[model samples]
Target: MSEPALTKRGRPGYDQRAILEVAVAAFNEFGYDATSMGVLATRLGLSKSAIYHHFSSKEELLEQALDEALDGLEGVLLEQSAQVGPVIDRLAAVLRGAVEVLTSRLPYVTLLLRVRGNTDVERAALARRRAFDRSVSALVVEARDEGSLRGDIDPRIVTRLLFGMVNSIVEWYRPEGPEDAGQLASDVLAVALDGLRVSTRSTGLDRLDHR
Candidate 1:
């Protein structure tokens, strides 16, 4: 038999998962709306028809990629460590789990972060993300109530700031870098739970009495 045909990119045998990886990368690099089926096909070195053989449309690809990120995050809440520990420990588990998810699924998480709710796929992803945030906020509140975390700041603000630090990793983190996910998670927890200073003496926030 003749040699198998190659795509324009000189590859053969594209599968759904491979197609999604490329699509998510393109979506993260260029906005989702701007990254179309044509763009994916071009990048994959395959024809649009070959792509459609795996997915009905670009929206399906987006939905699948978002699910990859959201499912991993939601699963973190279900872990035994996250479920049955002291609320402070549980919150730490969730935060560490979130970091693990982000680092392991960097491309998918990056795409999830960039979604703006412009399409139904994006809106659904946002809804799921908000639900995950709410769960983390609840953990924060419980930790404060148990006196493990400080009670001064609003739990909502604490949750936002905490995840803000976690999520910002998407901007500059590289899988090939020196720090592994576990180390990075430890660093995040140290900063969040302990603090930048050696001692815990209060200064600016205490003086402001913003509460």
Candidate 2:
């Protein structure tokens, strides 16, 4: 059979997914304003026209990438809130799910990281990001009210700090090839809930673990 029009190592026709994957990498490494469609083509070893066929422009690709990362949080927010057991448990579910999103959608999450509220697109992305943050903060408030979270820390400040740590993972954290994403997520949740701040009495998770 004849080889396709464009393929990896020049074997077959272009795969839109492969091309977009390259584009996402480029955008993540270089800011959206700095990355060009031509650079994306070079990275994938495909023609610029091939990328254009899949996405109209670099901004469109950015929009698409951010959508994938941000959308994952929506379902998490809905699912966690519906659990009636405890607020801290719900918040743990959120942070853990967020870490899963971090690993599963690395490229998209990286792109989301680069947005700085400079452009309209970036600003809109920031708004969406904050909305998800507010959702998580709401859970933190509930947790504090239920006596799970320490009353000394302001729920709003704690929520911001928690997400700040979670978001910073994109900067240097990479998923280990042999590590389980689920287990990693659980560990992160446990760390946040239990905290580096050790308690003399039974920990907040005592209730969760006994149930």
Candidate 3:
């Protein structure tokens, strides 16, 4: 038999996982709406038909990509590390897990973050993201009720602030850059949960005398 045909990129076979990875990166670099099947194929050195063979459409590819990112995050909630600890510690553990997932799957997470819910897949992804936020917020509420976390701030606001700080990592994090995931996770937990106080003692309104 003749040698197997090669794609324009001169490859004999395509790896589905690798293809999805390239697609995710392209979706991040160029807006998903602006990136087309043909453009993705060209970027991957494959024919449009080759890509079609694996993904029915760009929407399917996007769904798969976001799924990878969302799954990693959702998986964190199920970890024993996050499930059995004190409420405050559980919340901190989850935050660290989120950082690890984001750092490990940077492109997919980055793409998931940028999606604007313009399509059904994107909207579904957004719903899942909101669910995650609510779950984390529940932890904050529990910690406040347990008196381990400050109760003055609304739990929802605490969740927003904590994730707002963690999520901001997507904007500047580089897998090849100086920081590693372990260190980043520690630093994030330190700043978000521990704060900058010289001591962990109460310093805000809780410290004031009501008299």
lDDT of each prediction vs. the true structure? 0.89, 0.77, 0.88
The count of backbone overlaps in candidate 2 is: 2
Residues 120-186 of candidate 3: C-alpha lDDT, one tens digit per residue: 8989999999999999999998988888998889888888988888889999999889998899999
Clashes of each: 0, 2, 0
Clash pairs, candidate 2, are: 6-12, 6-13
User: How does residue 92 of candidate 2 score in lDDT?
Assistant: 83
- For model 3, the superposed segments whose C-alpha errors exceed 4 Å read 1-11, 200-211
For candidate 2, the TM-score is 0.82
lDDT of 2 by residue, 1-211 (tens): 1323645556656566666666777776776777887777777666888778888877788777788889987667777353667888888888888888888888788888778888777788999998988887888888888988888888789988887788777776676576677887777776777766667565546566557
Least well predicted 10-residue stretch by lDDT in candidate 3: 1-10
lDDT of 1 by residue, 116-178 (tens): 899888899999999999999999999998999999999999999999999999999999998
The whole-model C-alpha lDDT of candidate 3 against the native structure comes to 0.88
Ranking by TM-score: 3, 1, 2
Model 1 is weakest, by summed lDDT over 10 consecutive residues, at 1-10
TM-score of model 1 (CA atoms): 0.88
As a whole number from 0 to 100, the lDDT of residue 179 in candidate 2 is: 62
